[model samples]
Target: MEQPWDYLRHNDPAAAGILDALANDRTLEDIDRARILTAVDHAAHDLEIRQRLTAELTTLGSAAALHPSGLRTLPGTRFATHNMLAGQVRLGRVVPTANSALMRAGDFGIDHDVLRTSLMVIGPPGSGKTRSLAIPIVEHLALASLAGKASLVVIDPKGTDFAYDDWFDITIDPLNPTHGFSLFGGATNADTAADRLTAALLPPNVSDDKAYFKDASYNALYDCLAPYHAAYGAWPTVKELLALLRASQSVHDQVKAALKGTPGAKEWKEHLDNRVRQSQGSHDPAASLVERLARLDRPALRKIFDHQHRFEMRDINRPVRVRVAIPEADYPEASRVLARLVVSQFVQTASAPDTNRRIFKGLVIDEAGRYVDDYVARGVQKVRSNNAGIVLLTQTLADFPPDVRPTIFGSTGCKAVFGGVDPETADHFSRWFGDEWITQNTVSRGQTSSITYDDRTIFTRRSGHSEGHTQSVSSRRVERARWTPSDIITAVPPGHALMALATSDGNRVGPMLVNLRN
Candidate 1:
């Protein structure tokens, strides 16, 4: 007949204090409550005390509930509300139960701080991977931006997925010169510009032979840009860079004669001579590099990067939404180049020393596999402390090359896998979520016959026979994955996904189902 709080007060006064705090404080944040509950859970060794604490905690919010495995449970709406109230950016809601036919409010959600380590959302086309996950998160971030709590930068390579034109303050279209945005605005020196340009031109995995040529091309490009920086004190336009790459002798002589006493003029002249000599050879080391850079010579790309627009790295510190829309189908080659440029620029901006960690800055790349490289992966690893987050949406794990896939996967702290994923990718998630003990039931059947003659009866009457059957059933625990690879393929429905989130305490909460809020 005694109350749970009374028992806590009599036995464990510390847990009783936590309960008293929860009951008295009307404005206690969910995060603080979670921290208090975690402390209580650790302090209470007795099973009854823990159960009482969990019961009391659940009344605070759905997120207060704990899984049987002792991990805290967060429902979707609660997760979103917790983050929004706490000023953290929302990713999506979490559905605690898996393979459910219906969804409800108060589901768990992922936040920006959790995603500062990076996030990977994998599902096939038409599987609601974008609609249910990426878009929703982007919308939430945009809302946060509107409230002056955060900023957003979305790289839409396909250009069709993001429909919130009204939400973004700056919309950059590489195909439209009128909406121009500079990729080199963040480059402080010639060397940084060269590195950014090199990453934009080269893919993630370049052949050994191509790597040598890339280095040569980088040096040539650096020299060409060094003069422009010395004279103008700013990065050169795409048109200027292209002109230098394909410069004639007279133009070269003019640039050299004009900058004879510059700091890097001597080195630049030597590199230029080497490039000129190499150009005459049958096997030009910079031939492939030249061809890749030539893609930027198109009227659309040339105009886009010709002049710097208003969007810059410092804009992330303010409340702004920068949407980069590149249509891949219309300009396949140019799209790849532009996508790489935008992501690389973000990495450079995030890496700068003056970046503001107090404001939340996010970069969302839909169909990221088309553009992700080692630079982006390394950025993901380093951006956590800078108060920046990245969300990469890809159709499949196979979209990333073999060598860089592990780096991308390893850098990500959370992963949401939706339906229609292949067996191999599903198996990867299964292993990532790890194993659990499952109850296995075994049943056996047998038949037995016994013939007993009445001892008092004579031998002539001892012809009676009887037949009997027996059945036995038993249950035991076996270790197995909570969700098998096939379970993902067959059980997960559209608009639903299995999310495995890494908690702040370094615990993985769920590979549980999450219902996307429409």
Candidate 2:
């Protein structure tokens, strides 16, 4: 007259332990116990199997049900943690069944380590790229800051998108003088300062022939600033630099004569003389440089450049949030220059040596394509060792120039593709994710009939047979991109994205459909 539990105890101890736990649990109702017992019966075999079943049963019993609009959070691993939750491994409830429904709960996420290498997020307007991906990232970094694990810097060129002012400790308004940060901070020498200023003033899209003018302008600025720095032990202000650019002919001659004996001055003089000779023909190259820089001569921008409180690159290592807000609509040229300056500064800081690299630092650039240049590319290539991460957001591959697209794609270890992407961009991601072979199923049908004996009479008979088969074809093929460019353009709904995470060895883990939690 032994009970069923007793029978299991004598034969299968694993099963018996699960049964005892379920039966003795006070929280589970009779119906819940019955359901769990049925599942346990189906899974009762090896000890490992029983333990896994018990864990799942426990989850089912106590876990909150997911809403239709909600996607289960990605469980934390050694590389990444849930921003709001604390746990070593939090398994998501979403399963990728062949017939899975849209917006259903699912577990999909990129590794935190991959993020350190770099990340690119692309989607058209209103694709939830910012909310689902960027905002969550920012919140996670903020949480990490509070925990003393990381620091963050965000560049919001548009200004209006990031309204969460409370999340940041410092807000730099490039359009306001009193509350702005200096672009020339941390420059060790006059040459460095002049180079940064030149880069900021250079046009975003410039032709090859025009490159000489930029170099010549840089030389002129350097020649003027070098003597000033030597005499005063500090670099010139924006107003002072402008004054040098507007110097009278006699003043230019006097400064040139003064710097005649200085190192590098001879080369600078030659560049200036060449620029002057060239200006005698078509458009004046030096004048063009002056006009371009003149855009920053306005009151608001001048205040930003002349601000006394300069921003230091090393400040990013502290547990704080720094936001560089650029009012693009009001001052597009100045905004671009500020963005470039910030990127250059961050790159310079990241390139420095660090004794303890455990503290993570992040740079989040919204509309990043506008700011990416050779310096940023080089930084992405080297920042992984410094415990720094960069998150770049853009609408499409077209947002980047043709030459730079490869460097950006090659350096980034993680890519998240949202909906409404063009085919060209989708195809690029498709190829980047690489290719695989798949089974091709083929079906065929045939019929044969015969009639004989009485040709004189009218008699007929027919028979037919059908055949179906699946072939394991070895044709080289691309695994269908989780979301084709077409799929992104037409099929992807809001709040969901297709993500591909890469390992350290450069192997891709998934192009899974992830439902972003708002």
Candidate 3:
């Protein structure tokens, strides 16, 4: 009770664990042992949980469970929701393959440390990516959240995959009417909220040839949002923002009158002038972004956008777990918009100065391809250092633009490839896995012909012909992909995946096979 070791010494099972530790001839340093003890003690005051921690600490040392996963345990099968006490979750064990050695058939576990580096899992449908990887990790994080160590947000496009209602404090389902997400994702800064929404609402190619249009769209939204927030102290309603985006004459008149001689009034008037000027052209640059927003303003979604009670991204660092289920089937484009908005808002809020450093934050997007724009890809590297991590699940590498693929892949330190991935995607993984040196054998064979007239030289025409055969074996060093495209595409078992992991401190493993079945 007073001292953890003293408590452990009195526990017969835990005492047996100590004896086992002594038998191993290895031990953790005093500081590490103390840290583990303190984490365990703080996470649970239950006598039984403490005894469990004592046994685990004595047996596994530094790798022991840090604490109980949650206040209570739950049953699990294809997806596991237990054994997260160590601040880590076991994914699967490494497997040996024809092209690689099993350095160790160790289990792949991810905790806040590994997650701080972010993870990108790419595989086709029915590849066990969702069941084996996402579900386990999300389940672990949720349990960790209940232990008061993490905050989690799961964006479920299908609206059912991550529906553990009891585990999540917030279930954002628009169809339910009782739950929703903030229109601006609870952004504190007006311009930041404007920018995030602008990024999401615009087309993917807005930042391509006509980059000015992207800038204009951002500026256009900011002009209306800043003054409105300065006046009303809140984000504008979806209808109000829509009217502003369309540059309607009546809305501008009402806004101009409302802000006459107010702060930023002159700038607001100038932006209105430019908006009117832009609207006069045969083609308005803001048309594309407006079209996207109109999709959200429809009867199917406007209420949720304007929902009074909703979860905000700014509150994610408060030991909360939220599951946002988007109705992608009925509103495909709107769902993507919502997903993109969540990504943008998360990046902004998590990177802010006031974000809680002690609470680990995680975002798991079941199908993240459509939501990943240039902004999201670039922001991945920024948030990892801020105690936030994201798990991106994609069906194919082709979902990302060719130019941004490297940025996305490079930013995420942890990567996984499931069985049956396309050759091109496998090739990408193959190249990323790099090359290793191995001994290659070469067998050489040759035939020789010769003529002799030795013994019967005097007999003028006496001659002989001889033929000889020779063989030799030689070995040389050569470099080959650790996991070639062919091997990556074919060798991975049906219920396994290829994984590579890197911790926050630069520790890395894999380009190895992992058996997911077990």
Candidate 4:
């Protein structure tokens, strides 16, 4: 007779070793062995199940690789064991400790479906927003990336936290001095490169009446780069691109002379001609863009955003993990500007049609409120359908522009609110959770003494008996916010969070409390 363990010994060594370890434990119960044997039998026939079982075995050890792919783990970070083939990692279980009826004690996480719609996490520093939510999500995607399932791009302004350089394929660091980021976003298309650069350079969240600034900046870059690429057969460097953008009539004449007799000379020349005409205006779009671009174009950053030896966002089409660390300490303003560039490029790249539609793509921006604009807010929903999603971490909604926060919040499918947040952020979550019907129960009890008399007829009314007892009970359904601002602000513990999730197919789980720790 061949036992399950024997079948395992003949086929998979990893599973057999894990089974031996499980069997040597004297504390194992009959039911535990039965489940283990059953799992072994299933795992023999299924490779993913086998991988999950081996990963599960690590739980008994001092350090566990929590990712089911068995590809990697984040040591010192708390994680749960779950089969992530469905694109789910159980970060924590739900806890029954909130006013909302939607919440219950159970396993909770955002699978690929919920993530495809996008995730937004709000919490203050030391509130586990990064350790518990953002990094774990990135780690989960990292494991998926290794298993040939998905791709991820993480842009961290703080830079040091996500030091998964060992696992990732490329690291784009402005301070690295060698490997760096592309100012032009490595876009093959001229308009795309121009749009990405312009988005990164343009001030975000402009009002409707002032949209000309945004439109003009986009047009100016495209006009220069499109003709320039057609003529030069390559992307312009910071110096060359800046000159074309900040062109005086002399510079414009040189640009025009270079493009003369080109294939699209007529139309390209006209486009450049329009840009030169606008360069003299009171509110020139190119002027504003050049000003912003030049702000970060310092001598210290020359090698970082260079055209050569730079990481391109276009490489994300394959399964890869890219980290672009912005040097906030030295280049404070450049950090913000480059952060916008990374996000703008990410959104643009993710939104483009991919040949491998099934491979999921993710973008994680720690402290995203500073750089994410109305463009990302507006385009995320469209990005969701393109098999990509973004994970945003913010201390408060206040960090973002007032005009853009609502749209940003509204666009994401998953919103996780952690403790220690400000009243305004809590208040927004409270209202955003909206109203739910709750039964209100009331009970009244009273005693009327003999001295009591009716108010309607004081003199004529008879006095009450020695004592009269009255009791009443009533219950009615009342509408109220599922969770109040006070609850969102004070009630949630440090390690726990309140999350609402919506699946890609439209199934929704209203805001529920979840414990982020193991």
- Could you say which candidate leads in TM-score? 3
TM-score of each: 0.74, 0.67, 0.78, 0.78
Instruction: Give one digit per residue, the lDDT tens place, for model 4 in 289-398.
Output: 88888877787677777636778777666667788788889899888888898898888888887534556888998888888899989878988887889999989999
Residue 125 alpha-carbon offset, candidate 4, angstroms: 2.0
Taking the tens digit of each residue's C-alpha lDDT, what string does model 3 give over 200-291?
77765544669988887777777677766665678888888888778778887877787776887787677767777776789777777778
Off by over 4 Å in 4: 1-82, 205-210, 248-262, 265-284, 446-470
What local distance difference test score does each model get? 0.69, 0.63, 0.75, 0.75
Estimate, for each residue in 120-227, the C-alpha lDDT of model 1 and write its tens digit: 999998888777677767776765564445678999876768746465777877656556766564667888888887877866667887777778778777767777
Q: Candidate 2's residue-wise lDDT over 45-67, tens digit each?
A: 45675566556544653221221
Count clashing pairs, candidate 1.
9
For residue 8, model 4's alpha carbon misses the true position, in angstroms, by 24
Itemize residue pairs with steric clashes in candidate 2.
Answer: 75-90, 94-106, 420-488
Q: Name the lDDT value of residue 212 in candidate 4.
A: 82
| RMSD after Cα superposition, model 2 | 15.6
> What is candidate 2's local distance difference test score?
0.63
Q: Where's the lowest-lDDT run of ten residues in candidate 1?
A: 451-460
lDDT of 2 at 330: 88
Q: Which of 2 and 3 is the better model by lDDT?
A: 3
The deviation in Å at residue 87 for candidate 3 is 1.3
TM-score, structure 4 vs. true: 0.78
